[model samples]
Target: MNGTEYRDHRLFKGTVTERGIIDYILSLDESLRLNYNAYQTIVFTVTHRKPNLFRSFIHEKQRGLSAKMDQALKTFRQSEIAIVNALSYDYSNGLVEGINNKIKIIKRTAHGYRNFSNFRNRIFIEYKLLETKTAA
Candidate 1:
């Protein structure tokens, strides 16, 4: 599910108290829950900012929480700086991936291309059409 759906249902984050079980889960330790909310916020944030606050908070939180939480935090701790850097990394395989997907579609649907030159021309034509479409 998407963000809103998960927050409204799975996270038990809503005004309605019809779900007593969910309420109990959240009320177990309200402060811990608040800390987790902050942690999750840091994890989900997309900006190119280093998570200095998050790194410190995780250390403090790991001391207080369970072994299960410690395990997860351990993984994050190992890649702490990398996680922060991921926020604004420009390098991506998305363009190549998109072209690969289009190439696969062309290979699957088209027939009678007996030579590699014919297949190459078809792929070039596809890119040319895409370029024109984007230019317009």
Candidate 2:
């Protein structure tokens, strides 16, 4: 009924397949259809936890998702194992990196440290290593 309402509909806003248009449009040729399907499959495989299937999805059926898509596929092919690990694993080093950055900032703020002992004590207090000292 309204602009936003119309845009929210699957036909107007969702993927071509979800709109029921890409099904017929992309199905015109075997190669073209395969390319389209492979692209969609890869997109889903990367975002979802399907490491087992990602290898086949990328290397097996990915023929050509148009000219532009071929380059992207090539990149994925080169890092196939990494891509699979990313999709399948639930771990990330982001937290460790963030903590490292915080430590760097604290060290930078304390300008003149002459010895390792002073630096070590400062780091311990910064991280609240001694509960008694921190409580006071």
Candidate 3:
């Protein structure tokens, strides 16, 4: 599923009365339910734009856990600054990515244009830039 769908999934956004189904799964020995609540909190943080809470959650929960989770938390910690910036800023590369995707599709369908100039012109036309007028 895409990011929005995954974010809205039942496993991530459980009812107020109880935690998600993911929290019910136990490890091999069944001695402990996996501490996947961290993931739930992360979903909450990003969805709600709570960067401070994200920092706090990482600081408080990054210890005495399964090896996999520990590594995941470490990776989160490493990118903590970037994550905060993402949450704090409204900036996004989505428009650029969309343009690039369109260009890629055009290139694939055209089966390789004869020259770079032709390909560049095709991209400009796809974006509705018909022509450039020079100042007299």
Candidate 4:
């Protein structure tokens, strides 16, 4: 595993391969290449958690870009504060989100149980928090 491998994974290598494909496609059109490069800069800034760099790059480099990129930048600007907070802090809601996703999957698979107790029991069973009560 090489080229920015993490935990023995070659994710960035895959990214590089995909980027080459995109670059080739984008190079077919000058406008598309420009747009792709601009978008890549934004992605790099965000990935590195550089809000200040993002602000500067958006202000300086994003002028006269495509309408779609403008809309995306507008959305990012609107959520700038939240984005900055996310980049600045190490807090995560991943555990809670994972549990919520599991519950949703369970609900979908069950197809609407009529009894709430049974639903709760299913959750407890999934989490291994309850044992089956067998009759002798």
> Regarding TM-score, does 1 or 2 come out ahead?
2
Using TM-score as the measure, what is the rank order of every candidate, best first?
3, 4, 2, 1
lDDT of 1: 0.65
* TM-score, prediction 3: 0.71
Residue 120 displacement in candidate 3 (angstroms): 1.2
lDDT of each: 0.65, 0.70, 0.74, 0.78
Model 4 lDDT on a 0 to 1 scale: 0.78
TM-score of 2: 0.53
For candidate 1, the per-residue lDDT at 103 reads 95
lDDT of 2 at 32: 80
- Shift in Å, residue 90, candidate 1: 4.3
User: Any runs in candidate 1 off by more than 4 Å, and if so which?
Assistant: 1-24, 29-39, 47-50, 54-61, 64-69, 111-114, 129-136
Measured with C-alpha atoms, the lDDT of residue 87 in candidate 2 is 81
- Can you tell me which runs of candidate 3 are displaced by over 4 Å? 1-34, 61-64, 131-136
lDDT (Cα, tens digit) per residue for candidate 2, span 16-93: 334355555666787788777777777777777788787776676444467667777788889988887888788989
Distance (Å) between predicted and true CA of 115, model 3? 1.8
**Candidate 4 Cα misplacement greater than 4 A, ranges:** 1-30
Predictions ranked by lDDT, top down? 4, 3, 2, 1
Tens digits of lDDT, candidate 1, 1-136: 1222323446456633444544566589865776566556566554435466666755664445555666777887788777656644666778999999999999988855789987888898888842323454
Where is the poorest 10-residue window by lDDT in model 1?
1-10
Cα RMSD, each candidate: 7.4, 6.4, 7.9, 7.1
- The 10 consecutive residues of candidate 4 with the worst lDDT sum are 1-10
